[model samples]
Target chain A: MEPVTTIHGRAYPFGQKNVDTDVIIPSHWLKTITREGLGRGAFETLRADPDNLFDSVEFAGSPILVAGDNFGCGSSREHAAWALLDLGIRAVIAPSFSDIFSGNAFKNGILTVVLPQAAIDRLIEVAQSQPIHIDLDSQTVTTPFQDRFAFDIDPFRKTCLLNGLDEVGLTLAQGDAIGAFEDTVRVERPFLAVGVGS
Target chain B: MATTHPRTLYQKIWDAHVVERRDDGTCLIYIDRHLVHEVTSPQAFEALRLAGRTVRRPDLTLAVPDHNLPTTARRDAAGQRIAIADRESAQQLAALERNAPAFGIRYIGDADAEQGIVHVVGPEQGFSLPGATIVCGDSHTACHGGLGALAFGIGTSEVEHVLATQTLLLKQSKSMEVRVEGDLGPGVTAKDLVLHITGVLGAAGGTGYVIEYTGAAIRALSIEGRLTVSNMAIEHGARAGLIAPDDTTVAYVKGRPYAPKGADWDKAVAWWRSLATDPGAVYDKVVVIDAAAIVPSVTWGTSPEDVVPITGVVPAPDSFADASKRDAAAKSLAYMGLTAGQAMASVEIQNVFIGSCTNSRIEDLRAAAAVLKGRHKAPHVKWAIVVPGSGLVKAMAEAEGLDRVFVDAGFEWREPGCSACLGMNPDKVPAGERCASTSNRNFVGRQGPGARTHLVSPAMAAAAAVAGHLTDVRDMI
Candidate 1:
């Protein structure tokens, strides 16, 4: 994972609401052995439309996606995040997100910017002709027309995002304490210890 | 004044799992049981291999193949149960079998006696114990919370992390209490209760909170019924749903394959008994629902919350207070092929599917078989099938001759798997068809492209299969 502080580019500008993980990446695409090359399957259903925004050159290679409320509302498939990352989307601006999808996006180095619905609407409109800007350090998403929206993120998630700390890195940071806890559990609850007295 | 301390069941489990607290109010929580399925674990295992890492505690993890199993074939000519049908599914299951040994993780495939839906197998095998923290990459992991465990879904990234380190970094979720009082009326069930609750709370109501289901009605339910209620907690938008362990829970877990024996069992039961929420415990939110008020419920729209009692009518979008919700309702009505103000009972169906972690238990099978007994499916019904939650459930159902009853009733008595739930397998409602399903989630194209699903209880689904339309199970009973 890489640190994600800022994301700036033309957003997809589609304000579809309740867009589930199935629509993001259908279950058929989930059969793959690897997460690579998922961009082809991202929005496969929507991209089937001749007038789909995802395939439109105007939003092609967009680093940001401005969406509606309850985005990523179904399934715990990390492929939804993987597909978005593969499609070059670095940030998603929505009114709200499913907790599972939000966590997946963060872990995959994709920023999920939760703004008010009104702010999201404005961003979608501005994204039609101008690029959208997101600054995680400032916790604000801005547009060229002097439109600025501040958002709040969990301070812990923010720190992790800034530091590029995956769970492995995070856990390794508490190595000594984790080691001590294991020793105590081994002594106190030997039954719970893995492969102990087996 | 003396300080009064109140702790919820969630808090007790959270505190017990906390290994170390971070400055951000998050803690490293030790995970007791980690469940995995075919759809999610392949990538995580690949990541572990690439990183040259091994599972920290393989004994705590279990894997099964369900999402892609063939529900049609129980066994091949060689007397071995079919693990998968298609090439893609085969690759995923093969990966689990190959990876499990290398990591020392237990792999339960179709050939295994304990094989079935991951959620169902976990509890059936006594792996989902009370006061424990369980996790899986699948969102329905919350289903284990019925046994008084703290379980929730995780992403593949977290799955990989758990494989490497048997702990998850997390902040404790706020708690909510849902109290259901009074005895349930005849023909009403945990499915009806949960569907009614989702209707009142909406799909996103449980988000960011871990809910404790308490009160007389919840306590009165059988272990299987409680599991059904906790299984759909995710549908309420809650992170997890829990029911504190009682005598019923202890009875169900005792003597199982993984359950402790002798003195350890006594000690375990003592600790589990103490896990109940303390009196005067204050929750962030509390909802009281009268059990008598709930009727046989059915979902009428794309979302689980878009539900109504069997006797109720489809709601008009204008009845909603919020404009966005109103629009969403209208869209759902269109996609579901329903009219505003139309009676839900009048809707016809082509397929009836009764299987999922939500309602595929042996008890659910018995309920449907009871409804179908001495009756045949309607001539107009195209297809109806019953998939058990696990191999054990399937074997038990067969032993009771429930399979014969279903077969005689024109319902396919299929092998165990998550068939037609998410349409990852071959059993699916065809496009443009209307189905009365016992599975969770009625999302558009959930069963198949353009498939419209009406969520119902197993009995209701059986009744619908017999009537060739939406019919109340109460009438059949």
Candidate 2:
């Protein structure tokens, strides 16, 4: 994972609501064992149009996406996040996001910023012709026209994103605590540890 | 006097599983059971191999290959392996086979009688116990919550985290109780009730809450029925959904291959009996539904919340007061090839699918079989198939001659493995075709690209097959 501090780029001003994982990277694309080259399949359905926002020259390498409410509404497939990352998307600005998608984005170093619908409308308008800026440390999104919007994120997630921390490594460092918990479970919740190490 | 902290079922489970709590309110909660499937797990296993990290607790993990496995005959007439036609899917399944043994995790093979959808296999083997914390990479993991477990779906990154450490860093979710009072009418099933609930809550209504289903209507449902309701919690944006264990749940778990025996069983039962929410425990939110008002419901659009009663007509976008909803409705109508004000029953469908983690259990099969027993599919309904949830479910249905019933009714009795649900396998509805399906989602291309799906219960699906349209199951009953 790479550290994410600030991102400034033209945004894909797609404001479609209820954009699900099935729409992100269809189930067929999920057959790969590796996570690379998923950019070709990201929003495959929507990208079918020759003039789709994703393929248009203006937003071709956009690092940000402005979408509508309830983004990433279904499927726990991290492929959605992977697909976005592959498409050079570093941050997503939506009115709201599905819980699972939000977690998956954070894990993959993709920032998911939630703003009011009014703010989202303005960003979409501004993104049509200008670049949008997102700062993790400040928890704000800004446009060159002096439009600014503050957002809220879990403090722990913000730290992890800013530092590009490997969550597995961090959790492994606490192996002693985990082992102790298992030791307690052996006696207190014996059924949980049944048929272990056999 | 020491005051007893009246905790909800979720709070009790969370507290019991806490390995450690951080100042930021994120708790490193111990995971009791981890279920792994083929599609979402390959990358996680690769990450583990790269990190040189072995599974911390292989005993607590179970892996099965289902998503990419073909539902067609796994063995030829000579009982030899039938190779999967898709190269990529075959490779993904092969990876799981290799990684499971390499990590010392239990793997259910393609030909094994126990092999099934991860969510279905969990409760059947009693691996998903009452008060257990279960996590899987698939969104439908909430299905295990039917047995009183605290279960939710995680992504591949979290999957890798769980493999390296038998815990998850998490924040506690606010609890919501969905209480359904009154009796469900005839032909109205748990699937119908849940579809109605999804419509009531909208897709993101339960976004940050764990919903606990309660009340007399819920209590009356069978274990399989309860699982059907809990399975769709994700469709409504909830991470998990739960039902308190009762005699029905106990009976379902007793004597399973992985369930405790003798003294352990008694102790387990005693603990399970105490796992229900304490009376007077308050919740962050509560939703009440009149069960009697629920009818045989089906989704009219792509979103799960785009549902209507079987007797209703197609809703127009203008009927939605909200601008966004209205826009979505119009898009859905165009994509689904449905016209506003058209009667739901008159909306013809060419295909029918009776399977998924949501409704492929034995009871679901029985319900659909009962409806198909003495009838054949309508001539216009070109294709119909019934895929059981698991090999055990398939064998059980066959033992009761349900396969004959379906075959006689012109429906194919296929082997089980999430066939046609997400269409990752060979089974798929043709593009531009409408299907009456028992799967959870009606999302675009979920069955196949341009395949429009209308979600319904098994009985309703069977009824649709016979009528060649989305007809009311109550009429057939």
Question: Can you list each candidate's DockQ?
Answer: 0.29, 0.38
Q: For candidate 1, write residues B1-477 as lDDT tens digits.
A: 122487889987787677888787979988878998878888899878866778888888888889888787757799975655588878887888788878888888677778999999989988778888899988899889999989999877888988888888888888999999898998898999999989888899999999999999999999889988999999999879999999999999988888767766777788788778889889999999999988899998899998899999999999999999999999999998899888888999999999999999989999999999999998988989999999899999999999999999998888889999987788888988999999989998999889999999889999999988898889878
The sequence of per-residue lDDT tens digits that candidate 1 reaches over residues A1-198 is 678888888999889999999999997787897776799999999999989998897888999998998999998888999899889998998999999899888878788889888898888789899998899999998889999899999887899888877667678677777667778665544334542112
Decoy 1 TM-score against native = 0.83
What C-alpha lDDT does candidate 2 achieve relative to the native structure? Answer: 0.91
- Model 2 RMSD, rounded to 1 decimal: 6.3
Which regions of candidate 1 deviate over 4 angstroms? A1-28, A39-77, A80-165, A183-198, B1-4, B80-85
TM-score of 2: 0.83
Clashing pairs in model 2, backbone N/Cα/C closer than 3 A = none
TM-score of chain B of each: 0.98, 0.99
- Scoring only the A-chain of each prediction against the true A-chain gives TM-scores of 0.90, 0.88
Q: What is the lDDT of residue B409 in candidate 1?
A: 95
